[model samples]
Target chain A: MKRSIWAGLSGAVCLSALALSGAAASAAPRVELQTDPPLSQIEPFSEPVIFSLKAVADDGQPLEDAILELLLNTPPKTPWLTTDFPVVEGTMLARLTLPAPQGEAQFQQVPPIRGSYQLQVRVSPRVPGTFEPYTDLLTFQVPENPVKYRNLAILLSILLLAGLGGGWVIGGSQPPNPGEVASRPVQLVLSGTVLVAIATLLYISITAERAGAHTEAPTGQDNYTEPLNAEPVPTNITATLEDQAIATVGQAIPLEVELTRAETGEPISAAVLDINTTSLEYERTVFDFTAQTDTQGEFVWEQQFFDGAPHLVTVHVSPAANSSIPFEPFEFSQRIDVTGVAPPLFVRLVSLGYCTGVLALGTAAGFWLRRRSTQHAL
Target chain B: MYSSKLSTLKRAKQGVLSVPVQAILFLSLGSLSLWMLFFSSYPATHNTMHQTRHHTLGVGCH
Candidate 1:
């Protein structure tokens, strides 16, 4: 009787061990990425870099139905002309699929600028929830473009020389006679306008510089700071825009971003959110800012759209520093339509006004000098 | 001889007048060029001169 009992207990223990091993074997597969010409050899503005990627299961079989999403970000501290018209050359997004026969996919991209670029890749099976998702952040460097730097230097030198020589020649000419001066009222008005214009230009320059100084690049390192021993658990987070999708140019458009847990329908409060709006018509980033969710898991802000084109708005969500949740970071993007209107009149007037003022001052000085020299000759 | 000298000076003054004209011409050309290179949104022009616009001229070009 004792021998029979020992045999039955041993069989049950063996069966439980086999079930645990099977569960471990069915876990998510790993993704392997290789770059042609290697990432280290890439040069800015040179030949494009090719990436070869594959997803393989724990049993070493390639997962042919896997999908790969790639996002490349620009370098830090890039200065933009305006929040309305942003540069789009250095950033890109691509989605690729692995063919059944090859079991591997390839992507090619050219680096436009010299700096460290952050490439985020996410791999998931074709069928949702069939297998776990994998996320990876890879960084690569591209060397500076020497030829471009040299050309820029040459151009600047020519401009500087031309400006100096022109000023010297203009100053050497005679001036307008004081006795032939215009009416005092007209003179006062003109002087006042010029002074005000000069002050406005100065103010614009200073404020613009200060604003530019505040923009910093979003680094991937800061996005993912999970403890080394901590396991990455996927969070069921969903973001939705709760306002109208259409906006008018130069009018404040309300944007309300709401975050919620997909599983429990609970609000995910205090999460860090990064938002970027890029205009498809201009192929430029129109607006980008970072905000944190409130107690209700909502972020609300208003901005004036500058163009009458479709804009892509992307939101990236990450866990807050003090949060105990160890969820992976994710992003969502949507398109918003903007109705067309005439561009702002104030910017156009200011730029043209400043240019005209300088030209007029130079011309007036030249004529004044000519009169003075002619009078001296008499 | 006095009239001849006066004519020469007058001719020289006329030549000097062209200096201002030439100067104004240079000024206009430079202004237009700078605007196109740094400020204008001419396709590929801003991207090509991106570094110079930001580092040298301190113009914002992101």
Candidate 2:
């Protein structure tokens, strides 16, 4: 009896193990679906539509030898779906296709209509009896026809060309819109502001004379040669230069000084007039000169200049009072060298050209508008 | 007594190496390898669709 019971237990355990293994062997298969040139509900007509399919085994492993079919089954009402739908040749219905090792197995084709479409994939559909087939379905839309813009593009191009031609006709050599140039509000305001600024500067300059270093003396050296007691006491003195223009660097320049005796009210005869330069390097070397003034009571000294230098020359005049009369310090200066200091010629030319082009374009616009108004009136 | 114990150990090792035990291990290991190799997540399948869209747009599919 115990042997019979043991045999029954072993038989039951064996039966259960067979059942578990059978269930695992006959498990479900897997199917995957994909689309290429992906169906777009709203996209331009320039793009293409595509589809892809893949298959896997009961163990959820990709079944390489198994076949896959990517089917585009149209809806009932769609006239594009026909029995003569093209059959892909040489491609297996469920075969696993390898894409670039890193790419998807994709197929491309055009959609027949701009409407809803469906994609179906059947994996190992032909595998007889052993494993059930797997299928997947996907849906997407195709957009309607795009609106054409060809006419608008043409009209815009014509307008741009016409404007260019009108510019050429009105931009001929004369000043841009001469009438407008005369009437331009900005030009008038700018000129008025400049005049006011100049007037203010002149007023300040004239009033500044009072604050300037001034000495009083008689007008002529002969008046200074008279007896010292006869000369009137100078209440105010003024001196004027013969010229203000000086040459460029490395050029010799002459500076003249007019001195008036402070007490005499007339120019005093100077036994000697001396001119001295300050520490500022005006020339390669420091220079000092002394000379007797002409009857006009003017003393002049000529000196050479160095480039990019500032010079101050002081004129000291000795009067009959034995005291020297000082004149305002005069400065002579030269600009830096042209090669090192000047801007490139091309840049200046480009700026000038740009200005000229703007002026020409402005005139052209004005003329075109005037013509357009005249035509409208007629 | 030592020879008897050694014979018993040899018999036990043979039982461990029996055909039935090996069959169980082979099937389990095969199923495990298949799951690792081909039982990828559904996300991977969706990713492939995403990659296809990127390719159509001439952009990064990766």
Docking class of 2: incorrect
lDDT of each: 0.55, 0.39
Model 1, range A225-291, lDDT digits (tens) per residue? 3333333334576667644446765355667889877887788786777766666655655455455
Q: For residues A34-136, could you state the per-residue lDDT of candidate 2 as single tens digits?
A: 5554454433223334455456567766655443444453323322221111111111111121221111245443342344556655655333654565665
Per-model DockQ: 0.07, 0.00
**Which runs in model 2 stand beyond 4 Å of their true positions?**
A1-30, A41-46, A56-60, A75-104, A125-131, A146-378, B1-62
Please give the distance, in angstroms, between residue A265's alpha carbon in candidate 2 and its true position after superposition: 99
Real contacts recovered, all predictions: 0.08, 0.00
B22-47 per-residue lDDT for model 2 (tens digits): 22332233233222212222233222
Scored against the true structure, residue A187 in model 2 reaches a CA lDDT of 37
